[model samples]
Target: MAFVEPGVAAVEARQADRAKIRAVAAGRRAVVIGAGLGGLAVALRLASAGWRVTVCERYGSIGGKMNQIEEGGFRFDTGPSLITMPWVFEELFEAVGERLEDHIQMVRVAPLCRYLFDDGSRLEMTVRLPDWLASIRNFEGRDAAGFLRFLSMGAAALELSRATFFERSPWERPSMADLAALRRPLPLRTVLPYATVVERSCRDPRVRQVLNRYTTYVGSDPRRTPAMLSVIPAIEMLHGGWHIRGGLYRLVRVLGALCERHEVGIRTGAHVERILTDGNRACGVGLRGGENLPADVVVMNGDAARLPRLLGQTTASAEREADRSLSGLALLFALRGKLDGWPHHQVLFSGDYSREFDDLFERRRFPSDPTVYVNVPTRTDPSMAPEGCEIVFVMANAPANDGDLWDVSMLGEARDRMLARLDRAGLMSALSGADLVAELTPRWLADSFDMPGGAIYGANSHGPRRAFLRHPNKARRVGGLYCVGGSVHPGGGTPTVLMSARITADLIGKYERI
Candidate 1:
């Protein structure tokens, strides 16, 4: 054959393939397994695209990890305290011809987090450059410039990622814009490990700890995480952290509403036992009680590691304990009286940050001196509590190992360690008359979400390949099967999960539609 331009030939081939896909009418069915944010968002998108959609959730309520609890007039969000990249969410509403502002209010939280160091020193981290730089100068005058340079590098990574990684799966054909982004000169820091970059960029250990904490946002260890993951902090510094008026769970409610408006059906207490396939292509699902629901396409919103079990494979494809991400132990408190002088979010650092990660990832146990994170949602929204009470959420990172049993005694020890960290920061006294409403241990996360070891974001984003080469949205060996949510491509977080849904819906439009 005579040589033709490669791009042109590829376009011709895609066009020919498109012509072969038969057009189906409006009644084509889609089954979404799980009612998490990603599942609900894709269900809304497909339903809006004229395909009938049904979402089956194993739990009685929607919002998998992004759940909520209300007791004695106090409400606490179980997962994801705040959201950044608000525009990512806005796009989803815009896609379905709805306005996000009309449905929910996004309140910007100033001084995103209050960091309490081991020596009782406190600093407020904000997006306002002048104020933050001034604070940095007070702590370590030389680090101010380094901090700016680090953030600058992160901005570049975010720019490149938006053009490529965030747009589509790695297996898909890249647009010219994506290829152009790839050609751009990358920062030297982007090639280094995240922890190494942080240590090199800051003189003070406190600042390094603050910057290093970003890696844990995706359930990764900073020492091994790739430098491109710097985008996490860059996003927060650029867009500012936001909280819905009610709670982060409000986002799930808004997504559920959008799905309902598009005529999508949501079935709770419907456990999908297996993914039913016909001749290697996903046709529907088998419920736990043996009810078979047929559909043209199936999307999994649970942990990607559980896909094989649901497909009836003899051997498990679950991530190994060494490869799994960190899980958290959370203690939700409902205080009896008013507690002032606390921000919406605070991080109490451990004396030795490196050793803490060693305990979490290597020792495979809760840290002996674990860093504790405290979030008092009532600080931002008083409506979350009673007139004089507040809801306090205290959490610490723990290993996501399957064999570990977080029994009552184990939970008590973890709680004590967490409270001790808070006490050192002088915030524990406020909980003198508090009620411990609930505790979410790693075992609870594993059992409740069907996640292996309760690995929140599936595999840890360690090396470059593992960080970027995530499970694709479309399954290669299984036709008509797709994956979405925090565990899949584009990775986790509220905004990224929504992006995953958008990408999955577009792929279905391409391969399953004419």
Candidate 2:
């Protein structure tokens, strides 16, 4: 999948870009940087529209964060273990003359996740409302109805999501008429911090704590994350959670295949050093090896923080301006035995949730008592693990790659502290004998994924207007330069990233007055 290089490849690249935009244009071409999930979706969309799309990935394989790690016959998906909204993926296939059911096998994950609190009480949040109410009704009492009412509000919010709010490009500042169409009042409180809404609806302290963590999907502290993001509950509880058979990477494989099927040329090991531009319009990109790849449209699926450097222009970084989101310390283990009490997804929450966030975000230090997310993929996909062995993925929220606080030398000590948290949570005995496959730090994530500061969702979604804080889908100054990924509008997570691609691709088709 290497980009064809040397003397003539550069010449042909220039000609192809020229002919696409200038000629009869049936052979219009698109060049995509970074073949991550968003890039792959964009490529497929463009290819389906009769554009000659070329996706160049720096990684050896596609699937940026949706990477797979195999160790001692056990397989683990490094990023995004749970599939929240299946319809998003299905719609992607439907757009490209294919059906998702034909490509991937999916199994419903009942009892979506298990939440273990600091107190000895643990609650299993099921996809079915009856089962969910059965568990929480005791603590929530009459207020269980309030929780249901909150979800109804979230479902109504989805109507706005389908319109301009989520579908419209971030570059276009919405007018008063636009807000009217959304039916939101002036000076929108919908963009207010998520804590305001959660505190009003949730009666139980534990329920509020679990709901607050949903803000991490956009890599924001609960106190700062927007209330519009409350739809996360409806997305999981109503639609249900699912796991792709084989592994989550299977989706990436199918996407790559779909791109190829549509004649979208994919190149591996080609990293773009700079985006080549002709005045206001982007004409091409220059690879690290000094190779030029010209294109009519350049879709950068990389981090928005890299935009200034890639353009060779001096501009303020969206990352530096906004609070960068929290990063993670991931520990993958290959264990021979299984624990008696385990769910597909488990959250062993910290005793003091607010202090944990303060430690990570405000103090810029590791959490003294962190909420740990333990995922057992083998619960549904047994084939991922050998005979009796299981692959365990343990993730704890930590500060991003702040220059002073995090470094490789400190990773060992951090891993010990994380495992100690597990011990305190009462699951250390099961993992004590497991073989450690890898210990990854934020710096490693930064280098590996090209994330500036290794911040998971790019910018932290804080402040009064979370909408204006995120990077725009299209560059304000640079024409023909577009961005699609977790960092852009609609926020982070697999479904939203895919939605960004859909939105960006649609915007690319519209002609703007200069």
Candidate 3:
């Protein structure tokens, strides 16, 4: 199905309604910068509570990174391909008085992903507990029990996050959940980097490597990210990875419909150049066309790091670059024929995982032997491609460096490196003769989204400080200014971004009177 673009007629009607609303109280008016998932969501939420919200998107469409594109009769979800913690999505719809099941069909991805190591050994991760344990036992008898213990630790952390971390803002005073989570002594494992924890838990190098790969969910290096992030795999393995029937973009479609239903104004291609402030308070936003949108509350749904610049101050971005998360080089291909027996998701592991990360994070360059992620949504949802054809998404981590021009020479070199890694896994032959549909580099992301260096998750969750203390939902220095999205509090990923919206909306209701 084609992406559901916001109707021009509907947007103009909403814009007219917003003008009428402005003539009234003005106290309930909210201007949201960037019509990303979080921005659209919070706008819907506030509108439900009698707030007149107008979301301005720099891009021509909504959903931001959670977007879709179509080329050569193949539909490609350009952003996140997997969905975990399904309840988070359900809750968002329920909050807006809609049932998620009624709008979208979610299918559990069986044999979640296939892992291919350089040594010719393969493992299929499944949600079936018995089969998964059996695979571990067959691969490494000792690791079966070790893997369970590792998951148990992750479960504990996830449970703690549900109450304290995910539900409330970090700046909020300790609630009962926060106090309860702190009642016990902190585990020593919590302080150790995730890689160390993984090494201690899994005896097999392959198992440790797979476990370390979870750190990339938050765009962090495994050797440095805090162990609390173990919750990533725990959530995926326990709740299971899922795919929407048509495509992941279906979720964005439903969200857009809900936003429209709730009478939230959505203005696409409206670039906000500056967040107009009155002394210490945000009053509205100035669009690039010199059209100033006035409001009582302004919420930034773009990169939180860009707030300083929008507020008319410059930052020493070098510091941000040093602390930025890893970006990715994505190549979308439309293959003429399908590869039989291919799984929905697969990982081609690099021979030297540590060295690959060093190249990406420390050396600030693409890895010569990069680990590649291959996602063939057609394996599960054939509608993603034309009949008898397939769409393949290949991605590899790259340094989020502003210096890399990603010119033709650079892109060619990166593509060759990715193909080399795939060839080593003996899968390149299947992809031969495929047509490259589209490509995304860090530069494209940075330029399109205004994110610093195109760091997907804003900052790397390296040490505890970086991991726990992200950009807050409530802007510290600017009154009536709020923030949401992957870069803000509670951190990145689709589910967490929704949670940030909830927290930000709640904060606005509590602090600002309608």
Instruction: Candidate 2: list runs displaced more than 4 Å.
Output: 1-25, 173-181, 184-191, 315-318, 404-409, 467-469, 512-514
User: Please, what is the whole-model Cα lDDT of each candidate in the order they appear?
Assistant: 0.87, 0.78, 0.86
Q: Residue by residue across 1-514, what tens digits does model 3's lDDT show?
A: 1122223543353344334433443438899998888998888878866788899998888989888989878999988999888877876776667778899988889889999998999889987977887888878899989888888888888877876788778888886646876665545696789999888888988898889999998899999998888899989887788899999998888888888887888999899999999999999999997899999999999888788788888753535576998899999999999899899999999999999998988788999899999999999999988999999999999888888899999999999999998899998999888998899999988898787888999988989988988999998888999999999889999989998998888788667754
The residue-level lDDT of candidate 1 at 164 comes to 76
Per-residue CA lDDT of model 2 for 354-406, tens digit only, reads 99988988888778788899989897788999987788899998778548445
Badly placed stretches (over 4 Å) of model 3 are: 1-27, 184-186, 315-318
Report model 3's TM-score to 2 decimal places: 0.93
The TM-score values for the models, in the order shown, are 0.95, 0.90, 0.93
lDDT of 3 at 405: 93
Ranked by lDDT, the better of candidates 1 and 2 is 1
Clashes of each: 0, 1, 0
RMSD of each: 5.7, 7.4, 6.3
RMSD of 2: 7.4
Residue 286 alpha-carbon offset, candidate 1, angstroms: 0.6
TM-score leader: 1
Q: List the residue pairs that clash in candidate 3.
A: none
| lDDT head-to-head 1 vs 3, winner | 1
